[model samples]
Target: MDRGAWLFWVLIASLCGASAFFAAGAEGQRRDVRAASVTLESGAVVSLAEVVDGDTLLVATEAGEKVPVRLLGVKAFDTKLEKDVTKTYGQAAVDKLRVELEGKPIRVLLHSTPKDKHGRTIATLFVEEHDVGLDLVKSGLALVYTVYPFPTMQIYLTAQELARADRRGLWSNPAAVLRADALSAEWRRQAP
Candidate 1:
């Protein structure tokens, strides 16, 4: 080929390469923007690294990010941070959660609000193909927190009420700590 013809082909090839690079960069930016938006529909498989009480957890996603997840519409017994004291039913609630979800793959459904004040991702988690938040309420391990309105909030609240009436788990105690007062009294001093 003549020099002019070869030079023309090289210019076209360079333009094509530049276009491809810009296209790829734009796609990446779009994905990042979507992730920042409210209510993403994508699914993520995460391993449960730690249960922060019954309703929150530290999960390691397949993408290698460590995320804190707050269970939607439920409140569990508070785990004691200090060695000097323990909360009633706190350890039991954690034990139940660990048995049900620890080391297992969880599916998270993010809410429009996204993160809480503590920086934990506010989401509804599913485990073993069932709604984890509902299960905790049905089993009487947690109470319906109703601070936010969600699609499944009513269902969870109903189940929790039944568990309370049946006097299961935390409900069985004579002290009967409600979600608001669960952290107030010591375990041993509270009636059983």
Candidate 2:
């Protein structure tokens, strides 16, 4: 082949390769954009199939997938395992959650890490257009657990502090001493 012809073919091949690369990159970006949109705008609405505890529940999606959902930024009274031995003000916290969300459809927004170590979906829950995490903090059922940046982290934290000062829910109970111990026990019980 002539030198000029060989060079022209090489240029064409390079252009084709570049086009393919960009097309693939664009496709990947499209998928990412879609996923982000879903996570941010459209939360999965599911039925509360099982209650893991006062602050967590197992939700059954419309697609028949059962996912364990941990209420973001809140820890309520422990009520799943033992009925007789209850934490101070624990039953009140559980009662509040039950009144707000039991048997209702809940919206679940995903975080960067979808699941925790126990395979539960770590997400911010919502009911009736209200963020469940924020509600828990406002009601003093849970604390603001900020592991990563979220849209309403600051607001939730502030609300939780106010609730703590007001001594709401478990905060009011003198028996509920030692935040670290309570948290550690909760984690240990939940851990697989």
Candidate 3:
């Protein structure tokens, strides 16, 4: 090809490349939700690195940025934290969540602010169509975090009540039940 023709093609290609780069960067910054395109209604799919407990986890974006995510509207037994009540079933809770989510791609549904008090991403996580918080409560490994404005609060409340009534999981253990009662009361007092 002639020099002019070759130069013209190069300039067009450079412009195209610049535009594509800028467009990609704009897309990344526009969401401002959680990382990895996690929208409120749809959510982004991410891989679970580990189940921190029934209510918390470590997840990763496709680019491998590890994010701490706390399950919205869930309160599992104490893991390695200072608690007013004893941790009667922490391992059981962890095991359940781990089996369901660890190393698996799960969808994180945004609910409230992107982060919690501890800076963990607060979202409703799902495996396929099953909500992790709802499943844990239904299995009696967790309780509904009763703070208002939580999505699916009523469903969690009813499910937790049924679990308690049926004496399932931690509810079946008297010590755990007692501890949970104290914890609930304490949370109520501390809640805004």
lDDT winner among the candidates? Answer: 3
Candidate 2 at 183: error in angstroms? 5.8
Better of 1 and 2 by lDDT: 1
lDDT of 2 by residue, 1-192 (tens): 999999999999999999999999999677534423332224778776666576777667776555667776666656544643335345666666677887888887887767666556678878888987688668766655554456777798788678778887656755553662476466556544
Q: Residues 1-192, candidate 1, lDDT per residue (tens digit)?
A: 999999999999999999999999999776544433423233766778777787887777776556777887777766775542225566767787788887788888887777887667888888878888888778777777765677887787688779888877777765544433453233224423
In model 3, what lDDT does residue 164 have? 94
**lDDT (Cα) of model 1:** 0.72
How much lDDT does each candidate structure score? Answer: 0.72, 0.67, 0.78
Pairs clashing within candidate 2 = none
Off by over 4 Å in 2: 1-42, 80-86, 147-149, 177-192
Which candidate do you rate higher for TM-score, 1 or 3? Answer: 3
The ten-residue window of minimal lDDT in model 3 covers 31-40
By TM-score, the best candidate is 3
Question: Which parts of model 3 have CA positions greater than 4 angstroms off?
Answer: 1-42, 81-88
Give TM-scores for every candidate, taking all chains together and pairing residue i with residue i.
0.67, 0.62, 0.72
lDDT of 2: 0.67
Collision count of model 2: 0
